[model samples]
Target: MDVGVILLTLVCYALACLLWWQLHTPVFLLCLLSGHVGALASPLWVLLYGVTYRADLGVWFDVLGQPVYSSVVIASAWFYPLPALIILYLHRVRWLGARYTIALLTFLVMAIYHFIIETIGLGLNIWSYDAAPLLPFGLSHGLISTALAATISMVLLYTVLVVQRFSLISMVLSLVPATLVFSLMIQGVLGAPFWVSLRFAESQSWVLIIGMLSTLGLLGWAVHIIAWGMDHMNWELV
Candidate 1:
């Protein structure tokens, strides 16, 4: 990890902590938690895709021969949730008002932000993809994929908020939209039919993607249930 990246990440983490203290809503906390969880879980996807795409993590520093990119991953977990919290705050203050409207707006904001950050990183040689995926209009390694992934993760977290009871079954079902959207986006971008695309990918990649998705879905659902249960218990005690 670059010293600069470490310092910047710490500053951002401090700011996030301060913001959380000031706002302190269950919904906001949940969003923060979800983002961190997603970030932590992203290595599954990264490792799977490493067979084809390689990311340059800015610097070559290592800990016990392990790349310091782990720090970057941890920092990203906190950073990803900031947008969702902001959108939710806007809604709480009656600025956005509608749930679906907030959801759409939040997705757009996050997608654009992801694109900008990714472009900058690529320009700085902070990361590069090997055998890059194709995008519309003959572009390669477009940031849209990352944006879509982030949006899907946030949407899944948001779905938990709208539900009265979080269950494994409900969580699995809620993933359908995100899974479908992601699959279609990748398929369209790569200009490959869905079944053909899977056939081309290594079998291990399929297993990893499936495992990662399932793990994330279960983790998000667990967090929602735990948070809700705590709230319910507090109400009962009162």
Candidate 2:
């Protein structure tokens, strides 16, 4: 990692801690930790994508001959969780009247936020995708893929953390749904069904639709469990 990136990450971490203090929600740390784990776990999916599609997600900077970028990593792990945490805090305090409403709105807001950041990042050559397909008016597959993946991961992380008490087990379990949804979204964007996408082959539309619905159903059930846990368990700062 570059020295500047490391310094900036520390500064961001400090600000995050300060935000946690001001918000009086120690769950901020847990959410941040979950985001970090999610980001770290991304390399596995990145490798799979690279092998399956020959695409590179991003390359802001490299460290130790690896494609990891510290600035992006820090943003994804730290800053990305702030909006979700704020929304969750509001919901927890009853300022937000409905959980599902807050959840849906949060997801939309985060998706647009990430999409804008990705557009700027692409313009600045912070990253590039290989032979990316263009959408209307020339938006590339890279921008859409990154934005959607990041947004889904953020919202899922927030939902899981809010619904379940903070614990190692809960955090790890959260990754299950998050990763599953992420993989499904990416495969959809890549124009393939789940199994065929993994094999880097073409897929039928019906198969794609079925896979997406099934995965969404599974993810919805996981979220329901989280919601039930939230209502039944008296969550506390650990």
Candidate 3:
């Protein structure tokens, strides 16, 4: 199972590299960069959520190693970049035009993406959700936080790449902010309520429930704000 996880991560990197080699576009370059950034920034997710890593799966940099909640492993890197690539592709091609539509689709698609990834990770014993999960599939606030982060990140990407038409250098630099956006979203904006509840109300199920609900509400509002910005914001700023 550990080998499977390793192979999967390698395969993803290979695919991303292959795609970049073929297209040689800024979009694909950003995708590859996203993987590297995600690798470094992923520990923020671990810090905000309840997750435990398998002893055998392997760790690259152990940010936190408490027995109950472990830091991210090497396999964590591949997950977010793929979704970033996909969401950016959808935006680049203008597949979904309406802000709300794109927002909803992005959220659902990222959710499903993480769902499949988490399923494999959980099935293979690479990682386990030890926190208060609202669902059996371990689709807890922790997982939802990443999806929401992806969604928010997409909005920023669209603004920079699509709306503002920034130069290649600017686009490259945008990667840092893009990466930080995920960390901010997970650690502060959307993950805070659930994380606070997780810490203080471990025994109270209802408190966790409220926290999840509040997080969901914030997610919806975020989507709305992204959509509204796209619809009405003056894109004239240089």
Candidate 4:
């Protein structure tokens, strides 16, 4: 990557900060970041799927349908989601009903935006398509993945923010850890693994599987808890 491209991206993000002000604070920015990180993680699936295939997957490139640029962006997208999830999880614990619903809804909303971008990627050949049915929300490879991510982010964030009554400063501070954790996740997803656990997890293979399942469960529980709170408490959406 050239310094110019990096500089340009930084500017884009700075614009994104401005855009956030025009939008809904860090929440909107988190949605965009999640989408970008997810795209970057495409290489992870490629490596696993490529090796299992009998033929060569070919060099990762932009034109050849495996562009390194897009891959990095996707992995970058993955970084924002965890904090969103954490935020949502907290909301569910404190008060479920509508606040949790808002959190849940925002997560899904973010995923939808992410899916639109991913759909564009598939068309651009940023990654190889291996759909058995090729339907959205089926194999979870295309736009469906986008929807899922957005939904999860919103729901989770809603719960966390409402439950914790987080101040802007704390929410912003949380992003630091989120970025660190996800940067590592993205690295692992891209075969780099800045941390040993990611590399070791790759070796075990089941580690990633367990991690993903646990994430799913935690997310689901978050939604469920919010439901419980909603029923028990008379929380209404503002």
Candidate 5:
């Protein structure tokens, strides 16, 4: 019963609903959809790191009597929607473009945001990232991993919205399992190295370090892909 997190989640959901009602736009709906997807998909990352790299949630409620934390699950509802908010804000300001500037800026913002939240979670005993290993500045592997997930997902979501132009069909499609599928795919792909190293390597000391570097390299590649995709996309907003 992490009261603070629960309250924050409620506020986020309420604000999103209010905005959607007032604006009647697809972006807010996208945020809400992303939140739902995050709630479902967020725990998978924890499950990965928990088994391999040693992350843990505090004594919160579990899913299906499993070790999953309810706090972790609910916190994701707020976390995942943030990228949609970023995309919407960037699009509104005409700052959304196919360039390194937009992609890098988005990545930095997401990374900082993820790092801060993870640090706070660690401080609050909501989770632990110290068991296996840590990055510099006492950062957790989850920081880069999640930021990459969000940034890549944001870019892909933008591409989808641009292609579909928020048509009624597109709206319906984007607001459901499609978002979940992509979210999972992005996370799974980006997180594979770390999981593999920790899962299979008898001595994960060097392998984990290599895995971390590989994950960073993949993140850079993903960012580059975002820029390339943005360049190819036509600016057709319906």
Candidate 6:
């Protein structure tokens, strides 16, 4: 067994369980996972970038008379976005059936989460925000990051729920793609490039268009496979 993958699977399951309990539905799991994925990956990106790029800077920059770019400053970012997502997801998933309302609410909560993380990030001097302040809600990048991820997650979850009711096996496999994405995210946790932002930019119609098509293709295939099992294998819902 791949222990690492197994552990991630367990984590995803636990997250699904938690989200379902609060929301009384499983329709928000995708967004919840995405939000957590972003939060987890962001700090890693900051740390990797710090080590990889710190040498480029001439010397230590001081903030509040403290050298702000130290290793702790570089490393502390790992804790944000992740916890914030879990907390916000738990609160927001309960509104899953609200459609546009849920989307807006999730976006609002995630925006605040991103804002706080970026604000703290700037304060620690781990990274500089283009916004030029350690205040949350003042950064467009922050809002865009959280809002976009949340939106995608909601769509994934809603589609999954509408197409097939969750069962033990479906629930297990439902997370495979997200698990893979999370693993890739973990592997690339190092500082985000403009490309990462570009890939996630909420306004990128092309990406959204591609994502919708890809999601439909993938989901269609998955439902077909599930139907095969239901028809031929005598699979029963748990």
* Best model per lDDT: 5
Candidate rank order under TM-score: 5, 3, 2, 1, 4, 6
Q: In model 3, how large is the Cα lDDT of residue 173?
A: 74
**Per-residue C-alpha lDDT of model 1 across residues 1-238, encoded as one tens digit per residue:** 4566567656655655665577543344344434444443343333323312235444234433334455455455445555655554564455654333344455567767667766766676555655433323443444434544454545444554453144545534443233334323332332223223333445435543443344335434533443454344333222
What tens digits encode model 5's per-residue C-alpha lDDT throughout 87-175?
Answer: 66556556675454765676666667767766666666665655544554455666665666566456545554463347666766665
Model 2: per-residue Cα lDDT over 1-238, one tens digit each: 3455457556656765775677554455555555554454344444443312113434554433346544556655544565666556565565654344444455567667667766666675655554322233354555445444545544454564554454656654654345344434543433233333333223344553454344445445544554454444333421
TM-score of each: 0.53, 0.56, 0.72, 0.42, 0.76, 0.36
Once fitted onto the true fold, the runs of candidate 2 whose alpha carbons sit more than 4 angstroms away are: 1-12, 19-24, 50-66, 92-94, 132-139, 142-147, 154-238
Clashing pairs in 5: none
lDDT of 4 by residue, 47-67 (tens): 433311213323345422544
Q: Model-by-model lDDT, in order?
A: 0.45, 0.49, 0.57, 0.44, 0.60, 0.40
Off by over 4 Å in 6: 1-96, 126-140, 152-164, 179-238
lDDT of 6 by residue, 124-151 (tens): 5545534322222343444433333333
| lDDT agreement of model 3 with the native | 0.57
By summed lDDT, which 10 consecutive residues of candidate 2 come out lowest?
48-57
RMSD of each: 10.3, 6.8, 4.7, 9.8, 4.0, 13.0
